[model samples]
Target: MNGGDPPFAQRIAQVSESHTTRIFTRAQQMRARGRDIISLAVGEPDFDTPAPILHATARALADGRTRYGPVAGEPGLRERLAAGFEGFSADRILVTNGAKQALFSLFQVLCDSGDEVILPRPCWVSFTEQIQLAGARPVLVDTDAGFQLDPDRIAKAVTPRTRAILINSPNNPTGAVYGADALAAVAAIAAEQRVWLIADEAYHVFTYGDRPHVPVLGLSPAPDGVITVRSFSKQFNMTGFRIGYVAAAPSVIQALTRLQSHTTGNVCTFAQYGALAALEMDPALIDRRRVALRRRRDLALGLARALFTCAGAQGAFYIFADVSAHLRAGQSSADLALRLLDAAGVAVVPGEAFHGPGHIRISYGCDSATLGRAFARIKEGIKEGL
Candidate 1:
């Protein structure tokens, strides 16, 4: 075995690099080299972890609560999670390292070689990759102008091999929050087609409209094959803590728990306590953050529309603007992103990585001043063709 040789699994070799992560890495590298970069690339909150949660974590650390726990999660945390979902119980929950890991484990357990999972385009970058990593095919369905999942498109994409339909509400990249009617249509399709409906509700707590965030599980005559994945990372500003969970049928939860036991046994003990604390703490703090994010969303959308001719944001902390209006002949989103970084010191993820070319995702999770500066640079960069 030569050191320079690629020793390996063919499956691993076939995997492609994650576009968002690559862009984020490049931005970090440029910043390290002393570039004055204002990054709107990553989909994370720019706020500090809420004070109560921080204090709770500190207390847990001082209480000598650090030890290996259940593979599913700390028993009490799992109970709390189950209770959080209105009609679910502990049997329906399986907590894992992060929502990412929990989702990976779910895909591993549910999908097999040649299985098909229907994905909505302009999706989170990881969805397709995760399906491929599970030896499954991702069947992408394109959304409308607002990026809402079209039931007709999803229905057309279904086939014998189609085992599941994965949806992200308050979606990443595009902030289209699926409404009740659209969700009902999807649930109907999944039920009729006998496919799993996996809803990623990581942004569940961050809705800015008249309609509340509706989970698939909450639908009446609930699709028997629905699974809801939730994360504390975004809601509680606990991304570093790496704690998330899934709620589904008892059998599905059991399978995921078994898979977790053989793989990463459990999330960090203290993190579980921290998450529990988040659930028990003042719900008002989360509401406050929601309002703040809504304000950011509105500001970013206004700036995005002023700069580009395409769609503006509706929900989530991101505004996915079509940069095609500004594209030069043969220029890719990568080129535009690099030019923006070099000329205006602002960083954003190109849409090609999200399977939609000629666009970019701008995160508005930072403070108002930082967001103002970032958008001003973006405006200048676009006008100057940088």
Candidate 2:
């Protein structure tokens, strides 16, 4: 073989780095150079992890639970998670490093070459890449104008090779929470068409106003071929804990366990104890945080609407604002994001990353004061067109 040949696997070329993280890294570099930067890019809660959960994790560490754990996760954590969902037993749960790993493993176990997974546009950036990494294709469907699920469009996108349909409620990037009817219709499509329905409920607990998040598995006469993936990250402000779990039929759980055994083995041992404590945490504490986030959402949304046309976020903590008005003819959201970063001293992710090219996603996950300051800078930067 010629030394001139590239040495990477062809599959490695199929995916790109996460645009969100790229923007974050760039912001960090700028900050190191003494530029003041306020980041509204990454979607992570600003709150600290609860004291009870921290104490439990510290206890686990003190007890020397740092060794490798069961491949599927600790029994106590799995049992607690399974108990929350109807018909799920501990055997049906498989914990992983995060919801991301749970998803990657699911794709690896579920997809063969050339298979397709249907995703609604403006999805989390990793969905497309993860599907690609599994040697599967991601078939993207555009959501309705309001960024809500259009089951009809999804139904038309299905073909014989279709493998699964993934839905994220209280969706990322666009903070649109999917309606129950649309979710049920999509579920019906999956069941009737014999495809897997994967629900990524990472932000399920963060909804606002009259719109509460609906779990796909909670549907009465619950549809078959459903898998629910959830995380401890959002609920407990435990993002660094790296603990998330999947609930599916026991066969699927066993298959995932087999795949994970080869990959990450088990989730971190002490972290599982922390996750267990998260479940036992007081409902009032989570409610308090949700209330606070709702207020921040209002503050961010008001600032966002003053600049660009965007729907009021019903869930999650992002405002996906259409910045097309600020772009010159032929300019993209990526350019606008970069201009905002340099000119406004604010960091945001471009819509192109989520397949919504005319917008940018601004996270409201930071404190209220920081969010307000960032948006003010964005306004002035756009006005000056620096």
Highest TM-score scorer: 2
- TM-score for every candidate vs. truth? 0.97, 0.98
**Residue 327 Cα positional deviation in candidate 2, in Å, after optimal superposition:** 0.8
Runs in model 2 deviating more than 4 A are 1-6, 220-222
Kindly list the per-residue Cα lDDT of model 1 for residues 74-119, writing each as its tens digit. 8899898888777778888898888899788888999999999999
Task: Report, for every candidate in turn, its global Cα lDDT versus the true structure.
Answer: 0.85, 0.91
Error of 2 at 227 (Å): 0.3
State the TM-score for model 2.
0.98
Best by lDDT: 2
The sequence of per-residue lDDT tens digits that candidate 2 reaches over residues 1-386 is: 67787688888887898899999999999999999999999888789999999999999999999998899999998999989987778998999998999999999999999999999988899999999999999999999888999999999999999999999988988999999999989998898899999999998889987588999877623454899999998888889999889999988999999999898898999999989988998899989999999999999999899999997389988899998898988899999999999888899999999989999999998999999899889888878876
